[model samples]
Target: MALAPEPGPDWSAALSHLVLGAVSLHAAVRSAPASRGAAAGFLLQALAATCTLAPGLGTREDCPSGAWVATVIGLPLLAFDFHWVNGDRSSANLMLGAGMALAVAGEHLGPEGCSVAGQAVLLVVAVTIAIVAVFTANTYGVWGGALLGAAGLLSRLDEDGLPLRRGDACRWALAAGSWAYCRALRTQRLQWE
Candidate 1:
């Protein structure tokens, strides 16, 4: 028997991701030499968003959990870029290692088998990014990271517990967070210039 058709994908959320990716790609290209690390981080983030949009845009059959993993790996790159600017490389290597470890753990957990754990990993990375942003006085980063963390939490909520689908809420928050992150990159590029 033929299976029922799935609902159409969230077009607004997909559009936001597309915008985020484009802006981030622009940031990566326009960043100054001293801000190459941040540019690289932006590029990685863009890749993550691209992964998220792939299924929705019909480039893939399903969303890859690699999006979260990539975000996890990219967080420390951003956190350390500012740290490096401040002449503090002592914890940069350690954080980078930790980010990689977290990415591996998140991947192993698998969103289907353990969505909460996967989302929790996303929360951890997002919170770390927010904390780092606060320390660095990056307003956009602080808000963006917080929104991303909120999205993670929202995604874990039961569908029956809310008036609207939790997935929709999560997607809206994720898209907003992505826009904020793109703004963060823009601000960082300006500082570098």
Candidate 2:
């Protein structure tokens, strides 16, 4: 009998990096401050949404338009980071900014050169991070992030194989994260009121 082809390095690295990154981001957001940290957390959730959406419209090559979209999305995120860092934002904001910067670095490293598995892993990581951010941030941010991450994960599954729906799990995590944020916010509001 013929043996199955071994998965490439890109696949393993992508998934591993994503999971690790998510864990790191989650920790960073948890310790972040209320103002800019919350904004940075939302930005991460937005990134998760973008990764999920990118695949469905077309492959990276087929859609130059997508690159434009990426630029538009990326610029504001960078600005957000800069603001957080330079404006004497909280240490939590700085940490969140650092986490996002790391994620962007990972994306640049992976790019089109990475294998399909690698891309899937990246999405998984993104969703995981977004979920964590949601729980640490506000209700609106959590809900929006969860929805976007879910859509992204679903699209990613369509491209890759079905046996492991890691993307889907990430989306559910986002939802859970959102729920956590909502509960936290409600509690806070009740105390204030």
Candidate 3:
């Protein structure tokens, strides 16, 4: 049998991801040239979105459970964006990327596994990023990181008993975050240029 298309939210989340990617790529071009890696950064974000939404695309059916794995893909995208904004791959980028990976890894683990580990990781990363965002006043980084984390967990809200399925909440969150993030990046690029 063919795989049924994922419902509206999944597609919408995917669409948001694509829009963010496109907007970022445009910002890079508008800034100046390809040297900034803006294209690469956005491409990575798009890749993360594709991976999250289409994990089971090549399989017999798309396994919705695998969608949370999008967090893993998000780590590299975060690192890339930081590099673009900072103009170099600083140690801070590496640390933040590792934290992102850990945070997502925790999401993948449940009570049946090592749940505490994951939550701790998520907390550390989230708090650290928020603090750094404030200290440095990197609005783009703050928005992107916050939204990326939100996308990772919020996508899993598809359980029963909730007012909205996790997927739907994730869609709206991703859509809003992606727009804000892209706007921040665009503004930053314009300022730099």
Best candidate (score: lDDT): 1
Question: What are the Cα lDDT values of the candidates?
Answer: 0.66, 0.42, 0.49
lDDT-sorted candidate list, best first: 1, 3, 2
lDDT per residue as tens, model 1, 1-193: 9999999977766776686667666656755354676677768767866776654653452345545554666656766665555456776666667767766776466557446654655676577667767876789989988988888888777888866577557656765775676576566556656
> How would you encode candidate 3's per-residue C-alpha lDDT over 1-193 as one tens digit per residue?
9999876664555665466445544543543353344344444444444544445554422322233232333334434454445565574466546645654565456743433443343334444444445555768657755875675576345567555666555545554554555555565555567
- The alpha-carbon lDDT assigned to residue 60 of candidate 3 equals 26
- Taking all chains together, the TM-score of candidate 3 against the true structure is 0.51
**Which pairs clash (backbone N, Cα, C closer than 3 Å) in model 2?**
32-92, 52-152
Residue 77, model 2, lDDT: 41
Give candidate 2 misplaced runs (Cα > 4 Å).
1-89, 111-164, 189-193
TM-score of 2: 0.33
- Of models 1 and 3, which has the larger TM-score? 1
Q: Write the per-residue lDDT of candidate 2 for residues 50-105, one digit (tens) a residue.
A: 44243474565633333222323322342233234334355334444544454455
Model 2 lDDT-worst window of ten: 67-76
Winner by TM-score between candidate 2 and candidate 1: 1
Query: Superposing all C-alpha atoms, what RMSD in Å does each candidate have to the true structure?
Result: 4.3, 12.3, 6.4
* Ordering by TM-score: 1, 3, 2
TM-score of each: 0.65, 0.33, 0.51
